[model samples]
Target: MADTGELKQLPLKSLHEAAGAKFGGFAGWSMPLTYPAGVMKEHLHCRDAAGLFDISHMKLFAVSGPGAAAALARACPIDPRALPIGQAKYTFFLDENGGILDDLIVTRTGEERFIVVANAGNADADEAQLRAVASAFDCTVEPLDRVFLALQGPAAAQVAADAGIDGADLVFMQGKETDDGWFISRSGYTGEDGFEIALPAGVARAVAERLIGDERVEWVGLAARDSLRLEAGLCLHGQDITSETNPVDAGLLWAIPKGLRSGGDFIGASALEKAISDGPARKRVGLKPEGRQPVRAGAALVDGDGNAVGMVTSGGFGPSFGSPVAMGYVSVEAKEKPILAEVRGNRLPLQIHPLPFQPHRQRKG
Candidate 1:
């Protein structure tokens, strides 16, 4: 276990404490698990209003040089050279055997410049991987000096406009660096119409204060954040995806377009291309438990004879759905075969459905 004292804190740590946040360790950061209102309220508030999340633990990296785009294509499955400026893409870094090392959002800033926002825990390794790719091209990959925050919900745009950010016009998957140097992306993990703000640490607090002061905005912690993403049927990186799994198993083949320029010949591309055509042995799916207790990650998915068929990746009581929802990898045969989830050795009937237990509110524009 990592030492609590060694955990880093968000730039708004003092503010979070002032707001009565209960802190916990996440990806080596001392982040809030919830505020005084608690996880349930925080989750619901993000569905009805706007909830502010201090995601500064996430790392921002800038890649640029004459061959940056081509270099990126060689490192990942996507062809960054064909990406339009301001466009954002969700992609994964893989090992030579087609296992997911990390998944990140890459935003094209120019013809040869891009910014990749990586998950907190994988930041160091992600940097090393990007640098490894850099050796093959004339590019520089380095962390950006910015604090990242996520503002999500139905009223998210209004809250941003009310705070004088003037970024309500941007739609999903688009990002722009403001004249003030704040990078705002019209995207979020909650599957809502929202924005992720990357700003200078010095000024982030002021903007956060301005937004939090609004009636529609309040501090939400990682606990609620997890439930929100689970309800939306989104993957939570370390849990749902890892170096042991490939994109095909996680239902992320769409991120790597085979027909387009594709994740061609990149690291795991050989195996991935074959897996894409043959289909994975198992795929991620949603599960609706038959009883009250919610199944959690690592719970076994079992067959009629109590043989393990798969394992749960994420599970919890979805505040919005008013029931328990979970995601797991089940045998492709289990898609047609009746299965049960072993909960504390007791068998609970499982109903398989397509991903995203709840509706995705993310705007296509």
Candidate 2:
């Protein structure tokens, strides 16, 4: 949705078209908004079976050198040096003021090699910041252009097996490079168990065709992806989180290890430490509106006296949950009863429900 300057197409554009995709602009890419099955059906199908998505718009970077881990630690809060080979960790890049610059997945492929996957909107800035820090550590940051596909759902493992891809040994947050140049990881935006495959563009179409050939697999688009992630209580970088949001207030402290919280040295350590000690002024919480009407993002959260307390970041109708779910930031003092959301100039009754309207069925083992 950002500017859409000369939209770029993914490698599987033709395949999506064949699947009856309705295209729309997102982060300067002409991506599919939905297929013939629509967002509701696609969202439910993924929960029951498998949903294949083209997430190639995300940026991938290869950081390798003896100082790769050190370089990443300086830029991000996580201690990459402690990351085991073939393991991946979700973390964030922070500005000096402790605000999150972006959230990313860092996979340690080797002793001195890692693959950093960042959001598309922040790619340019991420690459620049990484390069600036990498140079000081004698590390090299190389941008990679490849096809990124996510196959997610309850039956995703069987579908991958049907395609002759051996990922049964991998659990959540684990990835390994195949002999044929494919990076298969047991991770996804959806809470369901699945694998994300990154491979060369030359064989992308063939691989997608092979996967979708199964009866259980269906092509999904951005619309369903957003709803699915919302149901899973996952945060979208630019929307739910931004450069103005810090890890503590955003409820992302779990992503940062305790060691880092106590004594770690990183870009935003001081600010984060202070926030932890002082406590967050506002905390991210789940909102359950009373009616069937979906509460979209940017809706203001107010108190009984109609005073603005917080704002909704991600909100929508969850297909699997069968209810309108939303997540937003609320002031700590205003985290009281009778929280209302202003809809069409009318304050509607809502409750502070726990996050993740649905349970995460991730294959942790």
Highest TM-score: give the candidate number.
Answer: 2
Model 1 whole-model lDDT (C-alpha atoms): 0.87
lDDT of 1 by residue, 99-163 (tens): 99999999997777898999999999999999999889998997887888899999998889878
Candidate 1, run of 10 with poorest lDDT = 257-266
Position 291, candidate 2: lDDT: 91
Model 1: which residue pairs collide?
Answer: 77-263
lDDT of each: 0.87, 0.91
Per-residue lDDT, model 1, residue 55, is 93
Candidate 2, overall lDDT? Answer: 0.91
The residue pairs in collision within model 2 are: 1-26, 1-27
The best candidate in terms of lDDT: 2
| Tens-digit lDDT string for candidate 2 (1-365) | 34445899888888888889989898878899999999999999999999999999999998999999999999888999889999999999998788999999999989998999999989999999999989899789999888999999999999999898879999999988766767888999999999999999998888899999999999999999999999999999988899888989999999998999965768888988888888999998989899998887999999999888999999999999899999999999999857999989888788888878889999996
Error of 2 at 168 (Å): 1.4
Q: Candidate 2: deviation at residue 122, Å?
A: 0.8
